[model samples]
Target: MALWSGRFTASANEFTQRFGASLPVDKRMYKQDIAGSKAHATMLSEQGIISHDDAEKICTGLDDIEREITKGTFPFDINDEDIHMSIEKQLIARIGEAGARLHTGRSRNDQVICDTRLYLKSRISNVMRANYQFSRVLEKLAHEKQHVIIPGYTHMQHAQPVYLAHHLLAYVWMLSRDFKRLHHSYEAADCNPLGAAALAGTTYPLDRQRTTDLLGFSAVCENSLDAVSDRDFVLDTLYACSVSAMHLSRLAEELIMWSTQEFGFIELSDTFSTGSSIMPQKKNPDFAELVRGKTGRTVGNLVSLLVTMKALPLAYNKDLQEDKQGVFDSLDTIYDCLTCMAGMISSMTIHEDAMERQAYTGHLAATDVADYLVKKGMAFRDAHRIVGHLVLLCEQRGCALTDLSLADFKAQSSLFEENVMHELDIPSIVRARNSRGGTGDKALAYQFNVVKDVLHQQEELLNALTRSVS
Candidate 1:
């Protein structure tokens, strides 16, 4: 018979027992379940709701169960329904009547929510660290390849020249925002919900603050119904994971495109690439493609949780059991994708010469030519029209802007001067834009310094979380 079976006259059908079980999905939270039990027992004893000897025995019994689970020596039955019931039943069997006293003022509703929060708090820290690691790789790549010039595109057409460092740093900023989202998720999960027993306040003299302190929570959930029913923490985590995975997908899509024979901008290392079984000359960027594809799963996980929580009148529901698997799967997927992306960025080879060649090929200097005319005091829109005609002339003549004669320049606009020649040089064009946050050398150096400071702060935060969770 089950622990709650004392009120029932008959056993549950086998299929119903198996179908209602969450042990498989939630068994990973065993440590959190044990820790919550110990805190609750200690609080119960301090409040004079239970005997000190009974609380001590329950704590010792929980410690034994934790050790057994950690060592993989504990017996787990699917009929136990979930990790909380499994550990509690085993604790009662080990410590007799005292073990049964552990849940005196609590219900599984609050117990499971408390365990989920604790579990997510730790997992959020881990995902944050992984995100930080990926950002560090981007930072390192930007610093090392600071001088590599590439054609910056808008609408997939060459629009300007930018340092490769500047391009990579854009993704770093995206990841920095992802780190903030994960931190917000951590804050959402830091509240203790252990005293919100069964959607209402318990009658026993329970000290919620003591359990909060014991569990290292920053505060206790104020409303019992809200505490057990709210899953916004889970939603926050899924949102963070979803956005971060989308960033990774964007980066992966670029890597896949850059490694192609048509682009030749980069070559993924042999270790990160795979060969076609049928084609002898094939080396594929399969890992990047995989990361890009897995992003769909993360997005679906977020939507799945949202739909699950959308319409239910909360307080507590069996539907909440659907929460952990999606969150767990999304977190694991994002973590693995982050590590893989970091590996790809760290190992790939950049073809600087190819990038430079492409940087100069597509009339990339057209914008600079117009800027040159503007500097000569031509009306800006007129200069744009003149440069447009000049580009068309160059196209007809099968020559570049730099290849045009001084006469050809004067024919387009009298404002065109010998200085226009300098504007056509790709490197000169790249270095001319020295405004704040531009792709110029000085701008890149400033951004790199900012990245370093942000990384230092993230390291401090990660260390603090490590201490708190420990």
Candidate 2:
């Protein structure tokens, strides 16, 4: 018989039982479920709702169940409905009446939500650490590739020159925002929802604060109805994972493009690459492609939950059971994606010759040359028009902007001179961009200093947040 079978004459059909059961999905939260029960039992005993001896038996019984579950020795049943009922039934059998009394002041409505918050509070810490570790990999790459100049692009055409470090640091900044979102997600999950007890306050003298303290929650959820029904924390986590995954997907798209023979900007190490079985010479950036492909599902997970929760009215609804799987899938996906991205970024070989070669071509210096004409007192619009014509002429001549002699320049406008050729030098062009946050050496040095301090703070925070999780 099910836990609530007293008023019912018969059990749910087998298929219905399987369909409704969350034990399979939520069995993963056993530690959290057990921890919630322990806190609840302790609070019950302290408030004289249960005898201290009964609380002792319940706590000891849960400790035993936790060990068995951890060791894979515990029997899990789907028809038991959910982790709460599965554990509680066996708990009663093992500890007799004391275990049955553990749920006196609670309902599965509040219990599952409490378990979820506790579970997410720990898991969010891990995701943050993984995200931080990935940032570390990017920071390391930024240092190593700081001087490597590459063509900066807009609209898939070269617009200027930028150091490779400058480009990689863009992703790091995006990830820093991701860290904030992830931290907000963690904060959302840190509130205690245990004693909301099925959408109404309990008649028993319940010390909700004691359970909050016992469970390490920062504060208690104030409204009983809102506490039992809220899925905002889950939504926040999903949103965070979705945004981070999107950032990784963008990077992954770049990796795929850069590793191609046409671009030849980078080479994936054989360890992170895959070979087609039939194409003996093929070494593909398949893992990066996978990262890009997997982003679809991460985003879908968030949308799925949003749609699921849209119409449900709610102190507690079965629709809420639809929450955990998406959150679980996205968390796992983001972690795996981050791991793959870190490995790929760290191991890939940067082809300096190839990047340098491409950087020099593609009329990359056209804008710099225009700036040179602008410095010579030409109207900026006129300079842009003349530079456009020069680019067209370079295309016709099949030569580069730097290849044109001063004669070719004097023909466009008398303001052009030998000094204008200096602008054609890619390194000079890159070095000249000394504005704040620009790709110039001084700008990058400043950016690096700030990012270095930020990364250090991220590491320190990660260490603090995850200390209790592992």
Task: Compare the candidates by lDDT and give the number of the best one.
Answer: 1
Q: Local error of candidate 2 at 222, Å?
A: 0.4
lDDT of 2 by residue, 104-124 (tens): 989999999999999888888
Candidates' TM-scores? 0.98, 0.98
* Colliding pairs, model 2: none
TM-score (C-alpha, index-matched) for candidate 1:
0.98
Q: How far off is model 1, as Cα RMSD?
A: 1.1
Residues 1-470 of candidate 1: C-alpha lDDT, one tens digit per residue: 98999899998899999999999999999999999999999999999999999999998888888899999999998688899989989988888999888889899999999999999999899999999999999998888898999999998888899999999999999999999999999999999999889988889988999999999999889999999999999999999999999999999999999999999999999989999999999999999999999999999999999999999896899999999999999999999999999999999999999999999877999988887877777778988998899889988999888789999999977887787798889998888778888998787788889889999999999999999999
Show model 2 residue runs off by greater than 4 Å: 468-470
Number of backbone collisions per candidate, in order?
Answer: 0, 0
Pairs that collide in candidate 1 are none
Q: What lDDT would each prediction earn against the true structure?
A: 0.92, 0.92
